[model samples]
Target: MRIVIFSDIHGNAVALEAVLAHIRHETAPDLIIVAGDLVADGPRPAESLAILRALPNTRFVIGNTDYDVVHERDIEYDFTRAQLSAEDLQWLDDLPFAQTVAAAPGRELLVVHANPCDLRAAIKPDHSPAIIRPLLDGVSQEIVAFGHYHVPFVRTVDRYTLVDVASVGFPRDGLLRAVYVTLTFDGANWQIAHHRIAFDAEAVARDYAAVGYPNAERKARKLLEARYRHP
Candidate 1:
């Protein structure tokens, strides 16, 4: 079985399109998981949601930003809400926090926006085993996949193989490319592959300006630099 997972698509349809195209051209995945943070930042929130919803064999888990958008808690929630329809907001509200699926006959895979404990809680790549283990208290799955920090990484903590699929829109790892993860399970074990695809950062910048996106300057700078910047 093969699975592709991506997250942190905080709008930016251009980046999402590039990542989706890469997934289509490169692999025939049995399942596709959109881990969360669908649309809360950047531009084209509705378009980004539509693209993911139209894909086949896809599962969704709500991210912290998704939750914030639904609850009107995000700083830019009003801007994002203005771009989406009532139905779109409802769809975001209905997304589950986590998904556990059978990767193979006897193997299970856990997918979440962040850690299983909380959508806002992050499990960073630099964290040690002791720091990571407690965050996964009740998780029994062999593989735990998530994306929240916008930084991609794969780490093993105790019995769990933790995979951060990374960000498609707002990547903060200093790599100016859309990122996603592919998992291939051969009954016995799961092999992980990370794919980064280049996209037009200038187009994204134009999108923010074109749409009058909130904090357009900061967002464009972050996207171009591929790292977080203070406003």
Candidate 2:
């Protein structure tokens, strides 16, 4: 079985579209898991949500920003919040903190936005096994997938396999292109593939302007523009 997992789509519809196109033409995954932050930093929150909503065999888990938006706890999300409908907010609210599915007959796959105990807690790529050990305290799956730090990595700790799917929008790992992870069950164990798909970042930057964030000084506008330029 093949599975595609992505996360941290902080509302850049252009990036999400490019990744989705790759999934359609290349990966053709049997399952799609979106580990969260579906909307937060960039423009086109509603549009981004719509794209995932239209996909098949997809599951969503809530990230820190998504939790903030759904719970109305963050002021930074106000602009994107205004663009969403009540139904959209409800959908975000209903998303699970973690999802576990059967990958093979005996093996299981666990998906979470970040750490198992905390939605905002992040297990970064640079972290040592000692730092990563505590993060796996309550984790019960053999294969675990998570996202939050916006960086992609795969590591094995004793009996557990950990994967970070990285960011579909607003990547911070020194690459401008969107990043995600794909997993394939090879009968014995799972193999991981890290994907970086290029999109029309200029168009996404323009979208930020069209969505009422024309000022370069605004944090949201600056983030959207820098997403294409920076790591």
Q: Highest lDDT: which candidate?
A: 1
Would you list the C-alpha lDDT of every candidate in the order shown?
0.88, 0.83
**Which residue runs does candidate 2 get wrong by more than 4 Å?**
73-75, 214-231
At residue 223, candidate 2 shows an lDDT of: 49
lDDT accuracy of residue 197 in candidate 1? 87
By summed lDDT, which 10 consecutive residues of candidate 2 come out lowest?
Answer: 222-231
TM-score for each predicted model, relative to the true structure: 0.96, 0.91
